[model samples]
Target: MRNLARPLLFAFIALIISVILSIAVGSVDISPKDMLSVIWNTLQGIEGSTQLASTYQTILLTLRLPRTILMIMTGAALAGSGCAYQGLFRNPLADPYLIGAASGAGLGAILSLSIQWPASSFSYLFVPMTAFIGALLTVFIVFQLAKVGTTLPVTNLILAGVAVSSFATALTSLLLVNASGELRRALVWLLGGSTMAGWKPVISQLPYALIGLIGLSVLAYKLNVLQFGDEQAVQLGINVNRTRTMIVIFATLSTAAAVAFTGVIGFVGLIVPHILRRITGGDMRRLLPFSMIGGALFLLLADIIARVLIAPQELPVGIITSLCGAPFFLFILRRSKGKDW
Candidate 1:
C-alpha cells in the first residue's frame, strides 16, 4: 500500500503539472496565472474581460481547455486498455493499435467522415457509432481467428492481429484514394491527432472512457489470475474466457471512443504501461491507475510538443508518438527476442 501510494501521488502531481504546462505553452502563450484566472472566471460565470483577458479567455475556453481534457481522457483510455491487454495476453508487446482496434476504428471513422449526413443530430453520433462498431467487430474477428477449439494461444492471436491489421490498412488506403473532396482531412485524421478538439468531442468520449476505465479496474484481479494461464486460472476458480471477453470489450470500447473522437493516437498503450510496470511492478491494481495517469501526462506533453515544436505549424500527435514509440518498441523487441513467444 505504501509503495503504491508514492507512485500514485507522483503520477497525480505530474499530471496536474503537465495540464498547467500544456495550457500555458501553446502558440499564443498564456501564462499559468492567466490560465488559472480564465478557468476560475469561467467556472464562476464571470463574464466580460479586458481586451487582453478576453483574447486569452477565448483561446483557453474555446481551444486549449477542451483539447487538454480530451487529451487526458484519450491518454487514460489508451493506456488503461493497453495495460489490460498486456495482462490478458501476458505479453509485453500487446497494444490496442497493434492488435487491430485502432485500424478498425480508423476504417469506421473514415467511412463516417466520407458520408454526407443531412441531419445535424445524426452527424454528431455517426462517426463515433460507426467507429465503435468497427472496432468491436475487428476485435471479434481477431478473437475468432485466434481461437483453436477451446484454447486461445497468444502467438496465434498476435498473428491474427497482424493479418487483420494489414487487411484493414489496405482497405483504409483504398478508401482514402477514392475519397475526392475529403482526401486531405481523411489523410490527416488517419495520421492521428486532436486538432478537431472541442466540447463536442469531449462530451462524445467521456461516457465511453468512464465505462472502460471502471470495467477494466473491476476485472484487474481476474486479469492477474489469468496471467497464470487458463488451466491454472480455472483451477483457482477464475473463468478465464469470460474475463478475457469482458476485458476485450471494455478495452475496445475505450480505444474506439478515443480514435473516433481524436483520430488514432498510438504508442500510448505500448509505452505507458511497459515503463510503469518496471517502476511500479506487475500488480495490475497499482499498474492500471498509474498507467492511466502516466499516459495522460505523457500524451499531454507529446500534444504540447506537437503544438509548439514548429511554432504556428502543428504536427500530428501520432507522428510525435511514432517518433518516440517506434524506437522504443524496436528496443523492447530486440531485448525480448530470444525468450519464448
Candidate 2:
C-alpha cells in the first residue's frame, strides 16, 4: 500500500494540472484569477457578480467544464476496461477495442447518422443506444467464434476480433459512402473527432461509465486471480466463466459508452495500463485505479494539444493520441516479440 501512495499522488496532481490547463488554454484564454472569481461568485450564490466577462464565464461553465469532465470520463472508461481486458486474457497487448467493440460502435453510430431523424431530445438518445447494442453484439459474436470447447484462447480471441472488426469496418464504410446526412461530421467522428458538445453527452454517458468502472474496480481481485490461468483460478475458488463474463460485460459497457461519444480514440487503454504495469507490477488491484488516473491525465494533455497544435483549426484529439501512441505501441510489440506477456 505504501508503494502505491507516491505514484497515485503524482498521478492525481498531474490530472489536476491537466484539468486546469484544459479549462484555461482554449481559444479565448481564461486566466486562473478570472476562473477563481467565477467559481467563487457562483459558490456564493451571487450570479453575475464576478469581475470576469460574461463570455468567459459562459465558456467556462457551458463549454470547457463539461468537455473536460467528459474527457476524464472517457479516458477512465477506456483505460479501466483495457486493463481489465489485459488481465482477463493474460495478454499485455489487450485493449478496449481488442474484441471489435469500437468497430461495432462505429457501425452503429454511422447507422444512426444515416437516418434523418427529427431534431428532438429523443434523437440524441438513438446514436448511443444503437452503438451500445452494436458493441455488445460484436463482442458476443467474437466470444463465440473464439471459444474452443469452453476455453477461449488468447490467439483465437485476437484473430476473431480482427476478422469481426474488419467486417464491421467495411459495413461502416458502406454506410458512410452512401449516407446523405451529416457526412462530414460522420467522417470526422470516424477519425475520432467529437461531434456532440455541451453537457448532454456527459450526462447521458455518466451512468454507463459509472457502472462499468465501478464494476471493474470491484472485480480487480478476481482479475488478479485469473492471471494464473482458468484451471488454477477455478481451483482457487474463483468462478472462471462467470468472472470472465462480468469483466467482458463491464469492459464493453465502458468502451461502448466512450466510443459512442468520443469516436474511436485508439491506444489510450493499450498505452496507459502497460506503462503502469511495468512501474507498479501486474497486480490488478492497484493497476485498475492507477490506469484510470493516468488515462485522464494523458487524454487531458492530448486534448490540450489538439486544441492548440494548429490554433483555431483544432485537430481531433484521437489524432494526437495516435501520433504519440503508435510509436509506443511499436516499441512494446518489439519488446514482446518471442515472449508470452
Candidate 3:
C-alpha cells in the first residue's frame, strides 16, 4: 500500500498544479481572482460578470481552455495507447509510432486536407475519420503481413509496422513538397499541433475516447497475463493472439481518434507508462489509472511550457515533448544496460 500510495499522491498533486498553472499562466496572464470569476461566470452560464473582465474571459475560453483540454486528452490517449502497445508486445520500446498508427494518421490528415474537401464536412470532421480508418488499415495490413502460415507472429507484425510507417512518412514528405497555403496548414497538422483544437473538436472525439477507456480497462488483467511469454500466457488460458490483436485494434482506434482530433502528440505515450510501471510493479490494474493521471499532468505541464517558453508565440506542443522525451529515453536505455529490448 505504501509503495502504491506514493505515485498516486504525486500524480494527484501534479494534476492540481497543472490545472492551476494552465488556467493562470497564458498570453494575457489572468490573476487568480479574475480566473476564478471567469470560471464562475462560465460555469454559472452568465455571459458577463463584473468580477470577470471580457479580455480575460476571452483568454480563458478561446485560448487557454481549448488548448488545455486538447493537451489532456491527447496526453491521456497517447499514454493509454503506449501502455497497451508495450504490454501487448511485451516490449518496453513499443509505442503507437512503432505500429505506424501516428504516421498513418498524419498521412490521412494530410491527404484529406490537401484535397479541397468540404471544410465543414470532410476536411475538419472526416479528415480525422480518414486518419482513424488509416490507422486501423495499417494495423490490419501489418497483421496480415505478419502471419507466418496461419499464426500471427509479433516479430512479423513489428517489421510490417516499420515498413508501413516508413512508407507513410515518405508519402507525408511528398505532400509537404508539393504544397501551398492551406497545404502548409496540412503540414502543420501532420507535424502535430494543439493550437487549433476547441470545444467542437473535444466533443467530436469524446465518445471514441470514452469507449476506448472502458474497453481497455476491461482487458487490463489480460494484458498483464500477456506480459508473460506466450506459452505461459496460453497455459494460463489467455488467448494470446486474440488479446494482442484486440489490444492493437483498440489502441489504434483510440490513437486515431485522438490524433485525428488533435495532431501527432508524442512521448507521453512512450514515457508515461514506463514511468508508472517502474513504481507500480507492472500491474495493469494499477498502471492504467495511474498512467492516465500522470500522462494528463505531464502534458498539462508540457503544454504550459510550450505556451510560456516563447510566450504569445506558441511552440508546437510536439516539439516541446520531443525535446524533453528524447533525453529521458536515452536515460532509460542507459539504465537498462542496452539489454531486454
Candidate 4:
C-alpha cells in the first residue's frame, strides 16, 4: 500500500501542477485570479461575470480547457497502453506502438486527408475512425506474422513490428508526396500536434479510451502472472495467449484513438510506464494507474514546452516528446545491454 501510495501521490501532485501551468502559461497568459473567475462564470453558465474579461473567458473555453482535457486523455491512454504492452511482452522496452500501431494509424489518417474525405463521413469522425481501424489491423497482422506454431517469440514480434511500421511509413510518405494541397495536413498528422482544441474531439475519443483502460485494468492480475513466463502463467491457470491477445487489442484501441486525434505522439507510452514501474514495483495493479497519471503529467508538461518554446509559433508536440524521449531511450538501452530484464 505504501508503495502504491507514493507514485499515486507524486503523480497526483505533478498532474495538478502541470495542468495549472498549462492553463496559466500559453500564448496569452491568464492570472490565477482571472482563471478562477473564468471557471466560475463558465460553470455558472453566466456569459459575463463583472470581474471577468470576455477575451480571457473565450481563451479558456475555446482554447485552454479543451486542449487540457485532450492532453489528459491522450496522455493517460498512451501511458496506460504502454504499461499494458510492457507487461504483456515482459519487456520494459515495449511501447503501445510496438506492433506498428502508430505507423498504421498515420497511414490511415494520411489516406483520409489524401482522398479529401468529407467531414460528414462517419459523422465527422472520419479520420480518427479510419486510423483506429488501421491501427487495429496492423497490430493484428504483426501478431499473425510473429506467430510460430504455438508460441510467439518476443524477438520476432519486435522484428515484425519494425518491418510493418517501415512499410506503413513508406506508404504514408508516398501519399504525402502526392498530397499536393493536403501535404501540410498529412505532415501534421504524421508528425503529431494538439491543434484540435474542442469538446467534440475530447468527447469523440473518450469512449474508446475508457473501454481500453477498463479492459486492461480487468486483465491486470493475469498480466502479473505472465511476467513469470508461460509455464508458470499456465500453471497459475492464466491463459497466456488469450491474455496477450486481449492486451494487444485493448492497448491498440487506446493507442489508436489517441494517435488518431493527436497524431503519432511517442514516448509518453515508453517513458511513463518505466518511471512508474520503478516507483510502484512490478505490480500491474499499481503500475497501471500510476502510469496513467504520470503519463498525463509528462505529456502536459511536454505540450506546455511545445507551445511556449517558440512563443506565438508552436512546435509539434511530437518533436518535444521525441527530443526528450530519445535520450532516455538510449540510456535505457545502454543500461539494459547484455542484461536480462
TM-score on alpha carbons, each prediction: 0.94, 0.94, 0.91, 0.93
Better-scoring candidate (TM-score), 2 or 3: 2
Instruction: State the local distance difference test value for candidate 4.
Output: 0.82
Could you arrange the candidates by lDDT from highest to lowest? Answer: 2, 1, 4, 3
Cα displacement (Å) at residue 313, model 2: 1.3
Put down candidate 3 lDDT per residue, 166-285, tens digits, no spaces. 898898789877877666565566656674655777766666666776678789999889888788999999998788778877788678767875677778888888877777768898
Write candidate 4's Cα lDDT for 2-76 as tens digits. 446655677688889888989888889999998898889888888864534788888888888888888998999
- lDDT of all predictions, in order shown? 0.84, 0.85, 0.77, 0.82
Candidate achieving higher lDDT, 2 or 4: 2
Task: Determine the backbone clash count of candidate 4.
Answer: 0
Please tell me which predicted candidate would have the highest lDDT against the true structure: 2
Which of candidates 3 and 4 is the stronger one according to TM-score? 4
Tens-digit per-residue lDDT, 98-178, candidate 2: 779878987886777677787856556776778788888998999999999988988999999989999999999889878
Model 1, 1-341: lDDT tens per residue?
33677777777888888888888877899877887788788888886478888888888887888899999998999999999988888888889977888789878877887778897556557777788788888988998999999888888999999899889888888999999887777777777767575688888778888898999999888888888898999999997778888999899888887788778788999888987887777778888988998888888999899999998878889898888888986787678674623
Clashing pairs in 1: none
lDDT of 1 at 16: 85
